[model samples]
Target: MESEALLSVRDLRIAFAGVEAVRGLSFDVRPREVLALVGESGAGKSLTARALLGMVPEDATTSGTVTLLGDTDLAAQRGLHIALVPQDALSALSPVHPVGDQLAAAVRSVARVSRKEARARAVAALDRVGIPDAARKARAYPHEYSGGMRQRAVIAMATVNEPDVLVADEPTTALDEERRDQVLRVLGEQREALGAALVLVTHDMDVVRDHADRVLVMYAGRLTELGPADAVLGRPRAPYTAGLLASLPEHDAPRRRRLPALPGTPPAPGTLPPGCAFAPRCPLAADLCHREEPEPQEVEGHLVACHHWAELPHPAVDLFQEKQHASS
Candidate 1:
């Protein structure tokens, strides 16, 4: 592991029974960098995050190296340098405990702080995430807080320890428009203050554009593409990636119609598509693309797993820019 990297995942694999959720995944999170994992639901973003934090469900099994600023991979370190906020907000919190209390308990559970200190820390955490009158809010039960507040409370708990790296699974999922912006801003502020590498798992392109320095696009169980946010979002080279972007509603685009999406849902886990997992739905797929997997290839600093990447046009500057603009 490089001293510059706060977290690194290499050849990470995870499975439930015979079905793999993540396969041969590798990535690095440099110190103070924000990496966004963007993909549709069930595309292995959350599962990859869960495996790093050792939070996978009981029926699953995980493997591979997840190194964090040292020779030790997470498989060996047991999340000593990592912390996470899970995907499902509703089930993540304890229903009976006061949200504040539960958050304070998280501090004690992680770092052995005294109750008074933990409560103080808890109040501070809430305040850090933009809760007004944090102490009063802390005293309220989970049921007492509104959905947005609950989400904030969860963030407070996850960030309390100020770990070297933070994994946030859909942090803004439950928020309304105003609250979503607030949540995003809070995360940005928190990242600045904590100086922890943030791994944000989200499907929203706008969030990816606004917050991420780099984007990791996963399809099926594999990491399909990764690059600087501007490069990947601006001119994605993989067909699957291009399809996803083409499908997004571009408010800035001149076109009035919403957008066009690729046909067919994601393939099931145990039975991923034979070749490029996305070959069935990829418009540019060829016979070779359906029978042989593409190894990760580096383009500048970006990584792409596509058999026909060189043949695929740059969507923004070359092929889809006009279409992208009109969609808005």
Candidate 2:
């Protein structure tokens, strides 16, 4: 583990019965940095986040070295050093308890604190997340708060202990545009306030483009590309990465009536075919891709697992420039 890394994962793999969910994953997150895991649903994004906090489902088996703050084994130090903002705050929170009481309980679980002191911390946390009338809101049960407010409260509880790492799984999911931005802003604010490293598991490329320092693109239980956000999103090296961006409605080139899309859906987890999991759908897949899984290799300093990455042409930048020009 590197001394500078707040969290380090090496060859992490998880399987349910004979089917793998995450395969040979490795990554590092430095303090105060945001690493986004962007991919379609069932791409192992949530599983990876859950595994980081030792919260994988009971039916699964996992193996990997997850180190936090250099020496702490993440499995042993789950909630004490790391916390999770689960996808659904409504279900994650105790519906019967006052939101404030729940936040205070979280603080108490991680540290020795008096009830009065914990309550104070909880209120402060709520205020930090921009909840109006924080003190009063604390007394309300989860059902009383609106969805956005509940989500903010969940973030507050997750960060109240000032954990070294925070895993936010689809924090903006199910929110309207306004609420999505609000949740994103609060997450960024909280991460900065605590100087905590964040692993944002989301399928929203826009979120990744705006907030992430780097990105890890997962496909079919394996990493297809991982690099700086600009390079991966703007000039994707792997065909899969390019396909994802091209398929976006907003990325359609001028006058292009139909949006481009990858040909096939992701393979079922346990039923993954013999070779590269993405080969079936990848436009640039070659014979090698179907027979031998491509290993992550250095491509201009970034990592991409593609047998034909060198052959894949970077998307034309002028297409976007023209769109911007016309819109302006």
Candidate 3:
């Protein structure tokens, strides 16, 4: 484990019924930094985030060490040391209980506090997340709160315990653009206030560009690129990362210009390609790429997993554009 890392994940693997969903993965989350885990759906972003909090499903088999502040027992430390903000706020919150009561229960579960103190802390947490009239609003049920408010309350609940790490799985999913930004702002504020490391899992590149200090790009359940946000997003070394960026509609491009899209879907678990799972979809894949899996290695300033990373084009998005043009 790195000396400065708040949480360290090494060789993390999750398999379901002998089918690997998340392959060998390693990373470190430093204190007070946002590390964005990004990839398309079925890339294991959510599974990886859940694993950080020891929340993987019962039937799945997991291997790896997720150490937090020198503690390897994640299940015991969950909520007290690490917390999760699940994707669906409505489902995560109980409709039967008042929001404040739920938060108060969470506080009391971890700390030996009186009901009064717990309620006070819960209200304070709600207020911290900018829930207007938190004292009154916290008394409302999940159904009574608006979508945005429910999301904020979930954030408040996750942070009220003052965990050292927070793993949010697509926190802004299904939210409108304005509401998404607002929720991210609230999440950032809570992270700042708690001085916690955040592992944010989302498919949103725009969110990654705006909020992440570092980006970890996954493909077919394995790391394709990992580096500082600017370096990774701006000059992605891996073809998989480049392809993903190329597919995004550029702001300065013509509104009707078709975006370059990666040709194939991600391979289903248990049916991955022999060498590199992405080789079939990667435009730059060479014979060696098809014959041998590339482990993540330092290239320029980033860790990229690709046999041909050194040969990737400058302004990496052009790599995919040229491929698209050739195919057309």
TM-score of each: 0.90, 0.92, 0.98
Best candidate (score: TM-score): 3
Order by lDDT, highest first: 3, 2, 1
lDDT of each: 0.80, 0.85, 0.92
Which lDDT tens digits does candidate 2 get at residues 1-328? 2367778889999998967889989888888889999888899999999888878899999888777776645665666689998889899899889999999998888779999999999999999999999999999999999988899999999988888889999988888889999999999998888888899999888889999999999988888899989888878887777777876777544666555556678887888887788888765667888899989998886799988887776473333333445555
lDDT of 1 by residue, 1-328 (tens): 2456777788988888967889889988988889999888889998888776766788887778776766554544433367776666668888888888887887777666789998999899999888899999888888888887777777777788787788888887766778788778877788789888899999888899989999999998888999999989887877777887877776777686646766689987988877788888776679998999898898767788988777777553333444445555
How far residue 36's Cα lies from its native spot in candidate 1, in Å, is: 0.8
Please give the RMSD to the true structure for each candidate, in Å.
Answer: 3.2, 4.1, 0.9
Q: Is candidate 1 or candidate 3 better by TM-score?
A: 3
Q: List the residue pairs that clash in candidate 2.
A: none
What's the count of clashing pairs in each model shown? 5, 0, 0
Which pairs of residues have clashing backbones in candidate 3?
none
Model 2 TM-score, all chains together: 0.92
Runs in model 1 lying further than 4 Å from the true structure: 1-3, 71-80, 316-328
Q: Write the per-residue lDDT of candidate 3 for residues 119-163, one digit (tens) a residue.
A: 999999999999999999989999999999999999999999999
